[model samples]
Target: MHAIIQSLCTLWRPSWQGMVMGELKYRRGGGSGGPYKVAASGRRIVRVSASSEAGERMDLLLFPAAGFAGGARAGEAGAPWHRFSADEVRRYSASLGDHNEIHQSERPIVSGFQIAEAMGALEGDRDFRIRFHYPIRSDEMVSLRKEGKAIYGVTDVLCFIWEAL
Candidate 1:
């Protein structure tokens, strides 16, 4: 099952990359000028300079899930950790009227929008910029945390950082 899913994701990568590149082109004329620092919770702040390609790549890396393999343990200090099942992913995709193949796979990948929904449910509505590093499989556990102006998604395999809006 994992192999099949991996192959599908591999096949889907080029199209996703093209979409991102297209969006980047569209955004070229709109953003602010050089050297911006994004504040995260606690005392961490990340600096990005618009003048450098490295900074742009770093920014891309910063923004970008799951599972319950640990016997259903509770979140630390009453934190809200969401578990995404195949059914929940289906329902969420249906609710949004999105029929993306990735969201409909046997071990469907949870959408970033759905993660935002979970974040809002836990911490109220707020604007966020999210970057995904991996695909979350069904039955995966996800947790959200707020530090200053950032919200992070914690999963067994990867961590996602969201800039609070």
Candidate 2:
């Protein structure tokens, strides 16, 4: 099971260079139970658990509910803000062949991929595990905050988190 989990982690590791744009540094703690850590460009860190079951159980512990409060604020130091329009969302959705009605509505719903794209372009060099807390509408503003290896997206609320690979 440990080997299976390790293999899965290796396979799932992000290969998108544009998605994470920086040199990767690897560090292995000296113990069988130690988590593997990979840091990227001083902004992102990927933690691989020593075992599969432990890894699964660690998700909630890694990101707690209180972490989403206050979200990312615009104009903060080191936090960059971005905006997307309904037309941009539609075009992006069409480009990806995603024809979801929610994305085409009058108050078009912004796809998560769109948010990932913007985050990837601006942040670069990280694998992201984003949790969508709210649906972003067109013309809404989104701000990104990099707290260590975690990147939070604040779009009127805590919208998503991009965990670096």
Candidate 3:
């Protein structure tokens, strides 16, 4: 497929240096509260998704990568979350060339690539698996715990992970 070929061609890029893999599952009526953007798109959001069932509510429908305008929804809670300024999330997206509505529903979200890079494992890795469960807005407080070779992005109801394989 052309998609496959294109991916291979771009493997030399910084974003592709890691042999990363992961999944973003939406449990319709469940939540995990990770940083995977919602699958829906609109000016409003209700529930959060997770890489795992950190929460139990999924209102995914429209998924955006960035570029939008509106108020952000409140974040869920379970683990302690810290503030991720709008400017940080916004600037990261601009550099990522990800300007989609779902990624920017109300608050901006940190992209998978950004997270992986932040974890200091995006480049020169043999393999990685990044999983997103929910979305972390630019203006939201998120949680992350790093252990060994894995870094977890946690929310009250969601959990995102980047691990080496």
Best by lDDT: 2
User: What are the clash counts of all predictions, listed in order?
Assistant: 7, 6, 33
Candidate 3, position 16, lDDT: 27
Candidate lDDT values, in order: 0.44, 0.48, 0.42
Top-TM-score candidate index: 2
| TM-scores for all predictions | 0.50, 0.51, 0.44
* Ranking of all candidate structures by their lDDT, best first: 2, 1, 3
Over the stretch 83-110, how does candidate 3's per-residue lDDT look in tens digits?
6676776666555555543344456555
Per-residue C-alpha lDDT of model 2 across residues 42-118, encoded as one tens digit per residue? 11332323233233211211122233345443334335477788888888767655545667778886765566556
Q: What TM-score would you give candidate 1 relative to the actual structure?
A: 0.50
**Model 2 regions more than 4 Å off:** 1-80
State residue 26's C-alpha deviation in candidate 2, in Å: 18
Which has the better lDDT: candidate 1, or candidate 2? 2
Worst 10 residues of 2 by lDDT: 17-26
